[model samples]
Target: MHHVTQIKEFKVIDTCRDAVVINTNIDDYKAHAHFADIRGALECISLINRGLLPKSRYYKTACKRLLTPEQYEGLVERTKEKYININKGVRR
Candidate 1:
């Protein structure tokens, strides 16, 4: 049998109007769970920075959490400083 090389392209038809409204209520329990997730992830990163991999598992239970850009940036800085201090002591 011979192989076919050319492939056919299909056009996507747009037939839906942009006038849809979705009303939903966000429960407090979900919000609190998300907050706990962010806090736990931050704590895990902190633990990893301190070179304690085994203890980091304690903070890996929550999910679907959101963190602000500023908070993430701050966490990065804090983790960096932690490594810096660790290396500083080793080089002395």
Candidate 2:
């Protein structure tokens, strides 16, 4: 049997009723990139929320690099929480 990959599509509607469709194949590399992007965005938010964004450059870099480790798993959990909330139509 041959393996087949399914492409998933996401649909979103704006306030003005404009609809947008995004096609995501989610290959391994793309999936890794998406995870990294989400982590990086969450790390930025964490730094800003903790008032560390304007701190030492070294600290900011280190935070972004280490914030997704097993010890810092809360960051990923927070990201998922925000994702769910947004999907539930809870606007920030």
Winner by lDDT: 2
In terms of TM-score, the best-performing candidate is: 1
For residues 13-81, write the lDDT of model 1, one tens digit per residue. 112321111111223333212213333434443443443332232233221121223332333222333
TM-score of each: 0.22, 0.21
Q: Tell how far residue 88 is off in model 2, in angstroms.
A: 56
**Cα misplacement distance, residue 3 of candidate 1 (Å):** 50
TM-score of 1: 0.22
* Candidate 1 worst ten-residue window by lDDT: 3-12
Reference-based lDDT, residue 33, model 2: 17
lDDT of each: 0.27, 0.33
Tens digits of per-residue lDDT, candidate 2, 13-62, equal 22232222222332322212111233343444445345444244543444
Runs in model 2 lying further than 4 Å from the true structure? 1-36, 54-92
Superposition TM-score, candidate 2 onto the true structure: 0.21
